[model samples]
Target: MERQVSNRYRLIEPLGEGGMGVVWRAYDELLDRTVAIKEVRYTGVGDDKRADLNRRTIREARAAGRLDHPSVIVIHDVVEEDGRPWIVMQLIRSRSLAEVIREHGPLPVAQAALIGGRVLDALRAAHATGVLHRDVKPENVLLADDGRVVLTDFGIASLEAEAGLTATGGLVGTPAYMPPERLNGEPARPESDLWSLGATLYAAVEGVPPFKRDSWAATVAAVLRDLPGQPVRAGVLGPVIMGLLQRDPAARMSADEAAHLLRAAASEPAPYGYAAPPAPPPGPAGSWSDMTGPGERGPAGTVSLRARRRGWFLGVPAAVLAVAALGTGGWYVVTTSQSATTPTPAPTSTSTPAPSRATASPTATPEASTTPTTPRLPAGWRRLANSAGQFSIGIPQGWQAKKSPTRDSITVTGPGTPGMLLVEWTVPDKPVADPARAWVELEKEIQAKGEFAGYERIGIRSTTYLGRPAADWEFTRQRGGTLIHVINRGFRTADGRHYALYWDTTDARWDQDRHYFDQFVKTFRPE
Candidate 1:
């Protein structure tokens, strides 16, 4: 905040602001390059306080610099000038995994596993160097634009351990993502990092924290005593969640085992691109390619230009939705077609104006466009509502919602596999708001009545429905190419509390009809 702090690093734009300090995208005149400068905010304290704070800052940077792993975000320098401490580090250009999953739902299994494995790898490196990350969450793990995972916010918490850096009794990490040991006041260690990683993976797959509460005290209670509703059964990840939530720190899986399991999970289909590099890193001759420069030869003496041009086609299925709205910005859709050959793009139309945010003109000046806006939806597609029964939400107009053959639910056919939408409404005489209890009963009921077996609950959260509170759950099962999307909303009417439940799948050529399905869910608000 002070101009010319130490008179060498010139502050530019602020990158991020946190309780401890403000991170600025700064220019280092001495180094003649751009770097991230973190300036500490000292409380109203005297000289003795400032010196102690500076010492801790140096210690953190020094400890982090000792780690020599690609997975860890590099910390370049730590400088103390005029009673304040500043840290210079590499600037990562990527959105946090937290931001990605927030815009979408849970990540596909591959991406989650890939991210989890890398975080564990980073943890191993930090522990090997006699240091703990102390904080591990989606926000701290960045998926760089270059498709690499970088662990950040290391050892910064230690700076706050000094009296001058932060106020006493301040919570240093994200609450829902904090491991139980951290809540219990135990010093962070390798096991603590494991716990945080587990929480992060859980949040990544479940689309929310494993343990959540509306109030702070309630959250603490949930973390200490509550069992999270089984997460969306992400095939192999189910067992991993069980291991991560172990109350006793010693009972949890080690970073080594977790990483190994993640690699194994990468083989299964879910969402997100977390698959390990191909047998030869997508290069020729079955060896890692050296596609380093603009015009250099890659593996097998092939021109690197070939690989660079083909990068967009790799692992990207056909029919991808790339749509932009005024206020909502961009959203993607992945759809599968009827022939099951070509993948359909997800619906990304921004036709419905965003009432919550401002909108820009359809065509902004090209010269003024520095950041590229996501493309608009293709012509002629219309959004519709999901009208199966009491479950009425928006959907694509032409897609058909038909009753399931089993007579228990209705399936809405879209253009692709990811495009199909299913809704089923079930009424229970006695309704319960707790997801764990509801899951146990629902599992038993589905097993007994539904045609499908092997049904498993993933994660559940308490949310409001139609102006009243309700519970939502995600499940995984053998749907014979059909993925069941179910929701149970409890409403108190003249007949007492009752539940509205439904299930759907993307088994059909789902992409043709996916835009409407996602929009239906996104706009679904009980009136």
Candidate 2:
């Protein structure tokens, strides 16, 4: 081991101790960042042991960073300091899903689904990137502050390591979360992960895994030969739980399919429990004490009946409670009439005035908001009268736009080397290239630009444009030799019509136009 290790990180207090490592709260000196540094001891063991440990540490770091999904914990860096290996991860101050369940028995079906969906999404990304998370237990899943599930701990995750890196014998995962295939020493696969996710969800909804026993061996036997108990019929997670627990991995649904179903279930009306923190208290128009206090007839902090009925945040059931208060922004805090277990104090005061408009008649849930039929320009994006819809934006005056013969839309370009803006329209029944294949093609385009340039491909996200089905894509590519990069956004409407836009410039120059990129995505309306 070397002295003091790297100058960048100052190791702080020990967070927790593990079988092979200890996690410390460390301050990153170089980046001025706070991160968790996990230190694994490398006693004067054989070279094989040291190599295996190093490989495990490096593999975990690579696997976690490879997944860009929000539901996966972010890995910052991995380093070997003074004869010991340490991996730094984002320091999240939230309870693990396992601890949360232990504190509050079983979670409601809706909450479980919300947490489950996010984990599955991360798994989808991991599998697509050729990593198998062999471990998917509750302890490894964190419940983020924003109410999202983040999967953690890939220390034993299988990856394409060199020949000397394999951990022989029982080097897999927790028995409860390990699928039968993995326990049998068979190769781990995506289906095995789905089985673990099912077990995690089962515990979330039923307060126990289908097979829990006093002895570890008994538990293993039960997992291999027995069926678990049924989850409470409190919500729509019933079928989903059963499907995930199927013994045959082939019978289990893929992570993507499971996520879609979970999202659909979360969208429906139900007796959902728990509260989402108020949307960052709209700039504090005034204090909760000043507005509605001790004894008020109409509940304070609630939205007007009209606004309540309008629904917000995935139609969160509490939105309809209607506790009216005065504020310029639309943030909600509970009144005395609401839950009695209020935790935090009311927000501060603000000067901005609330909008004065006739409340639109109550409509369907927010999720059912009208979809855009075609891309229409969003409010406030022009010198005057810009016709390209929200899905479109103005580029530097010299750039040009040309229609793609194969695609229904346009491809814009500028007077330069090999760079072009590609756009295409999609309609129902017409199949777009598979995402994996599209990524391959995009990789080719990226490699052609430069050897070390980086590119990010955001997933196909669903959004309503006006009142039709539409999806938006953002592709950011960096090129060599120039401090510039290219950004392209494409939209596909419900009817299968699609449009794509691109921008090419150095990063420093593009900073001036970065805000437009966000507004472009939000305001895109399909007419």
Candidate 3:
């Protein structure tokens, strides 16, 4: 007979056991779903102290329940039975980061950085709600099979609004990951949590904690008195890790700076001559393809536009010509005389003249000289400012600009040019989480529907631009019987605004004109 708790949760098996509790794989009869239940227990204490511990467990669990983030484990229910609290939580099918490192050795620097970023996101969310995760270590991080890096086990968390719960003289975190201030009997601050995060990222890439020692006492001493050895494998994450591990919390790196550096590290290109292992076959039990539903392969940091809106990027309609005739100073439009012959695609290589090459261009022209506020343009290049879109970019001499029909995007083209550059910013309701993954999903949808004629993919790579996560998608497709190469970069602003920069040229001129795309990206500035 299986043991039942609160007449709702049925214990299936013990998942793991630790000093404070035993986590069980339990079945929730009422919800008809699997859940994880942690049974809190106290030993070597008198009845009065045990009762106090029970109350603290319930309070902490309730405090943790207030947190809501994609990277945070959800707390479902907390109940007391037989003088102890049981915390019911979302059951994740995954292994802890500690287990992964132990079994597979150290992870790659980029992978470690990615995991660290997710954990930091969760920490920021919790901190915003006045909760501190007192125990943040490899054992508390869950790498879910569904490509989620989740922070779990908030059993020891503390609420800033509440008074201390721990007994008069007791520490409540793993020694190796604890900050120096915490060891010196100081209260845990947000920066203290950052220190632990740094230690966690170090262990993730080094296979050992920065302050690991032979015993608990030695580890505590090392954390409080000694400096950590430099991490050789940390790569771009080395400074971030060391900065967070500073003994003086006041001198540590700020969260914003850490986030920027982590994103940069996560987006670092693979080492030279390195090749990714082939993805496993789709039918495997734990394969990502098998876990996700059709067209839902996790956050790809990209959103799909409605089918009718697809033409905004591929073809310019008559409505755009009408917008040009209005002569609005903000509208980048081509002349009406050239509208008939111009294919006017949002931006790409086509036989027709580009919409931007008209004799009468918009008021926003290339910068004649540079100011401290304005980015300097290369020789023969000019800055084009779009007041309506609140963005500015550098374009080569003689390049013209045209506004899209929706007025949310702009296209620029040069005289007799076979290539065009487009800047778009029509973000949807939901923001993308992974830009590279979004491109992969988008590619599948387009290919399945045969949208692009003779389309072939080159690659979709993760990267960072403007200190934010971004991705670059490169491909080739047939346009008017001519092969054209295209690259589209998508990213979100710090304030959640999404943008994409697209450029295309005929295959014959791709090598010569590709530099324009790079220059455009380098000079783009969003107001």
Candidate 4:
């Protein structure tokens, strides 16, 4: 049997539940659309207190409804039914940031920065409207399947224009993420929210809240007394995180300063082992190209062939390539003397490859061919199936394929050129919805971080590929004093699989070898 609220919204199922409310997946009978309804329940309260709580719930919902920001959740309606308030909101198909961290371990530094920036944007918007989100933690941040980083669950939000709603001596937010001032019985200020944002980002990159303790009282004590543990994986985000977690709200970083730093960190190329470039000189938004001067290189300030590969891998997810471990002579060696070989077993977490070389089959077996529905490969190209990565691609005759240690990607290299073709399929639980926008954001980070020496961009454009949404990113960069041309195509298939096909070659030979990219894409197949 279904439950109806105010004869308009029909409850479908419970999406989630908290101590005070249950959120439902509901359908609006009047609007003929799906929406989320949060049923707020009050227990163990007198009649007068219950009425006051109901009034506060409606006021908060109305205040949240007035907020207009892309990153803020949309509040649809507040309905009174069965002597309680049902707050309707936009139905978002996504997982919380906490769930993502739990499933994938800690996020990459750049990824954490990007998510933090979006969440902060929402907080700033709420602050502008005098709506203080009392709870800003990983559990309240949603990574939507449509590529939106949304801040939600403003149920306990405090409106500046209104009187205090919480009872005396009662803290309203999670202790681990609460600012010290808030724990000391201070009012909720904008800076307190910034402190919470810092803690959320800390958890995003380090996989745990900064002040987490065995019990609530201990967590509160830790927040008030102990300094947070140093973040090891925060990389460019370390300073920002530490700055926001300051005990004195007055001494903490301002929202504008934090925004600038987060933007810079989000654009950084690699999370570790490199100092991020200084924040670009203040300019119009989206003017990242003006940051670097001529001959000004990235953090390391030089671009070797191996460094270029390392930077590219770092830009993607779950990249575990140890480029520095592969010495120069070993990386470029053409294994022509080796005969036909069997597929090597996939490397485990503790596995270590020989320092000289990783094993790779010289040719594809019969089963590696594309399905009959797809185009056949050219005479000289062979479709190689990578069982570990669960994908097949066509490569030129002389090129050799090396699988990544994590078995999430395969890189094909040829005899003489420094160029290589990389295919990666390490999709996160939340795949990108808009590829073109993603590339634009990535380009900003790459340029701001100065990862590419002598970097020049052609363009990033959205297009349709193989009857699916796709984007093409083309650019040129200097590698070992030789100009290199590169184009990367990313798309999500109908069955929700994400893949990237990247090809790079010398500028002089780009036109000559460009057909190889077409052949590779034509014969590519995802298992």
What are the TM-scores, per candidate, against the unseen true structure?
Answer: 0.51, 0.55, 0.56, 0.56
- Evaluate model 2: give its lDDT: 0.50
lDDT of 2 by residue, 1-527 (tens): 32233777787667766566777777887876667777777555788767776776676667666665545677777777666667778776545677667766786665576567667766776777777787899888875422334687766666644323454554557777778776776777789889999889888878777778988898888888888677765367777777877888888776656766675554333332222111111121111211211331221210000111121222122111111121332321110001111122221111111112221111112123532332333332221111222133333234444432212234444453344443332211112222222323334433554533454543323333333322332334444344444443332333222333333445565555444444444433333
Question: Backbone collision count in every prediction?
Answer: 46, 32, 7, 1
Worst 10 residues of 4 by lDDT: 332-341
Ranked by lDDT, the better of candidates 1 and 4 is 4
- What's the CA RMSD of model 1 in angstroms? 21.4
Give the per-residue lDDT digits (tens) of candidate 3, residues 1-527: 99999999999888888898798888999988778899998888889888888888899899888886656788899999988899998876656788778866787775677678778877887888899997899988876533346788888888877747864467889999999998999988899899999999999989999999999999999998899999999888899999999999999988778877876675554331111111111121111111122332221100000111222211111011112222333322211100111111122111111222112222222122122343456776666555444556777667767665322467778876688887764312111334455566556556666767888777665554555545566777886678988777665444333467788889899878877787788778655
By how many angstroms RMSD does model 4 differ from the true structure?
18.8
Which lDDT values do the candidates have, in the order given? Answer: 0.50, 0.50, 0.65, 0.65
Candidate order (lDDT): 3, 4, 1, 2
Model 2 residue runs over 4 Å out of place are 1-4, 42-47, 160-164, 272-527
Off by over 4 Å in 1: 42-51, 157-171, 271-274, 277-527
Across residues 1-527, which tens digit of lDDT does each residue of candidate 1 receive? 64665677787777776666777876777867667777777676677766766676678777787776656777778888766778777765555777667766687665577577667767776776677777898878876533446788774544223334434344567768777777877665578778888889898878888888898878877888888778874668877776877778899886666766776674443332113211101111111112122232222100010111211222222111111111233221111100111112222222222111122121221111112223222233332222222223343434455553212234555554443444432211111223223434444443565534455555443433333333444444554444544333222211111223333344243234434544554433221
TM-score of 3: 0.56
Q: What is the lDDT of candidate 4?
A: 0.65
lDDT per residue for candidate 4 within 191-279, as digits (tens), equals: 99999999999999999999999999999899989999999999889999999999999999998999888866754543231111122
